[model samples]
Target: MSDAAVPDLTELLADSPTNWGKWGPDDEVGSLNYLTAEQVLAGAAQIKKGKVFTLQRLIGDPKGDPVWPGRNPAVREMTLDESHWDEGNNGPAFPGGMHCADDTLTASLQGSTQYDALGHVWYDGKIWNGFDARTTIGGLSKASVAPIAERGDAGRAVLLDIARHRGKEYLEPYETFTHEDLVACAEAQGTPIRPRDILVVRTNHLQLFFEKGDKFYSDFCEAGLVYSPELVSWFQEMEIPNLVTDTIANEVTMDPHNGAALVLHSALMRNLGVAFTEICDLEKLATDCADDGTYSFFYVAAPLKISEATGSPVNPVAIK
Candidate 1:
């Protein structure tokens, strides 16, 4: 679609609901507030067999890492190594002539498994909690990942294996699922959606990216939850605190109907104050869940406490 034909997010979400001031003006963590002590205990109660799974994808996978277009995978540069401590090299020597390896990594905060600040995306001139978008000028002055890191994320989480439900290794490009589809998938998996439950959805969509490499972005549409007023309302009613997904963007890359991209970022994250955890590696978690028929688990994660960051890399943990 031509840029002229695309509808502005402001127009698309003109009547969308917002949680502004709902948690008071100073609140930055948004719906995460739903993860109360009771929710944490309920999550712990679901742990069985003590199996653990880490949801962060390898940062520098040799085979290549998937990232949103216009972004690059993490690059690690060795700053100090055994090579630097060679006989003639001027490597810094410690008391015992000890040399330790060190490396520096450069990457986009949202380029890997990450948690987006509530103010990460917005329409008009406002962000989550009605903060001015200008607050993000140099770095986020409000609703940055710092607050989320301090509070932490630990609660009952349910995994919805949409690929398994559809009997496919992965959903095809541009495919979409709705809230109703989620309900049905939950029914099939025997995992009912509950209020304040953290949702971990797996489509294994990045399989294509790993397989096709640059070719994966030829058309560049992702299979994910498309936007709708009803879907937004469902999230609000369910009081979802976090949405973790194995996709570049948690929601469809572009709304098929209106051509507006990432409407849910505004509808869910910005407006409803729902936290978004994207680019997760859920293969192990989904496989374990499928084998054991236990899709819900105790989930926890805390992003790096980078000041004023829009997002932060996170390795979320799911325990069963």
Candidate 2:
């Protein structure tokens, strides 16, 4: 965000309300610390019909129609005898020609449904809590995405279908919603924003992408929450441990305030120590929430165990 949009750094630091030292030294879990076992039990109580929704998009090659140029697309390969692994040449085959298959996948972890770890963002050569990123974040970092996966993020998930509240299938291109819009959405949905809850916002951009085309949508044209100091304050007030959205970026692709790139990524992940699950498929969730008038459910996200990575692919689930 622009310097004008953000408050004075000195003033913000002086009255910093971040959970830096609250979790103790060498703490990687940030707001996730608030997700107690009791809270998980309480979150599980939201389930009534036991309906499970997979929040991840299935990865696949797009048949030469990549959303973004040069970015890696999902590639699936077979490493076993199915791929011409002759026993005479490669000398590799299953015993008794059982033809057991082993497959390997090459894909971008953050290309589709993903999570941004605490170490994913860096500003001024430092990470969250002012740790030197050069040393603290490497192949093995201080705040890798692995721990969040190991723990299995589980809690109450609340869906804020802003598009539905606006009576639209999706928000328009490049539309920017504000913190006020979120409050209004919650009021309309009759769901209270609770602490340590996972927030899922449906912009329906995924619908547009699938309909209009990925390249058209991936060109940084979509609806999303705007980045502002007030947005940070909202996160602080809600104390949400995890955030997911159908939009490409968590915040608007182009800053409405100062034309900054991924400003919320830095402010939230790098400064406030909040993580994100971006580019999720929330169309069904939004439609269901609007239909049943039930926007709350049990959310669970278990990231792939890729140690020391800045982020990882995640298939977050919502059970209602």
Candidate 3:
């Protein structure tokens, strides 16, 4: 398809408001319900075409401190004599009966709570343009919301590593990123910001969470780093579809005592048709794009089919 044939960002957002809605932290389960067999084929074709880079975070336990908020529960325990299977009730009953197996598996990618699709959240109890949330995906189903499928594919994606562009692997506590920062990063990379792009930002906070141990979550909550309201307004004006990042909450951590939540979430998912992606791995892609001066790519994501659940585990990929 020619570039001209590609839908404009505003048109894409207007036609599929829920497309931007799938990447949020609080989007309703099953709000993204447009997964068609053709999308799966398109993704498979990209993989076959090569030059595609995988961006999903590895879903295994790391030996060091917790990479996220939860503990690693995959360690194996020593087996006692009684725990071993006896070959003989009185004598040897089976050959290989004395063998032992680990039988333990670690969980990666929290599926029980997936990223909310842009159509997932609603302001004034409604989604974009007064679509009722309860009657939509937020109300009846868990697999996907209306217009969005169980999985989503076929959109333009762009990466803006704000922290990296600032020459740091991470941002400081409570630092609010601005629209200028985003534009500056794109400029530095020589990639102009375009509308209808699925934008991914790298804070490198995931690495800090792994390094800080127990202090990570508390410190993050206290730091209050996030996007400003103006930035949200900018996205709506630009008509961007989806936004993905490495942070779990998709906004600056709130004040623990005050409970001030992510205003960006309210502005994007609630007001505009933009959604978010949390816990993404953009380090390698960002580094490469920054060096090569190419940041646009074909993006795709697939969510598991867990009925009535808040969210399912997803593995989203990007092809440059």
Candidate 3: regions farther than 4 A off: 1-49, 64-114, 118-147, 222-229, 255-259
Report clash pairs, candidate 1: 48-320
TM-score of each: 0.98, 0.87, 0.66
Clash pairs, candidate 2, are none
Cα displacement (Å) at residue 173, model 3: 2.6
State which candidate has the highest lDDT.
1
Across residues 1-320, which tens digit of lDDT does each residue of candidate 1 receive?
88899988888889998888989999999999999999999999999889999999999999998989999889999999999878898899799878899999999999999999987988899999999999999999999999999999999999999999999999889999998999899989999999999999999988999889899999899999999899999999999999999999998898889888888999999999999999999998899999989999999999999999999999999999
Query: Candidate 2 regions off by >4 Å?
Result: 1-17, 61-70, 81-93, 136-140, 217-219
lDDT of each: 0.93, 0.74, 0.55
Superposed by TM-score, candidate 3 places the C-alpha of residue 218 at a distance from the truth, in angstroms, of 2.3
Q: Candidate 2, residues 1-320: lDDT per residue as tens digits?
A: 55677644344434445666667767775777767897799789999999889988767735322233346767888776454655455635558856556789887666768887787776667676666788553464777888777877888888988888888877887788877887789888999777777778887765666666645645655678876677787787777777788766677766665566666677676667777888787877777887899999999888888888877888889999
Worst 10 residues of 3 by lDDT: 27-36
Q: Deviation in angstroms for 235 in model 2?
A: 1.3
Per-residue lDDT tens digits for candidate 3, residues 165-221, read 778868766665667877888888776776555677777766776667566667455
lDDT of model 1, residue 40: 100
lDDT of 1 at 19: 87
What is the full ranking by TM-score, best candidate first? Answer: 1, 2, 3
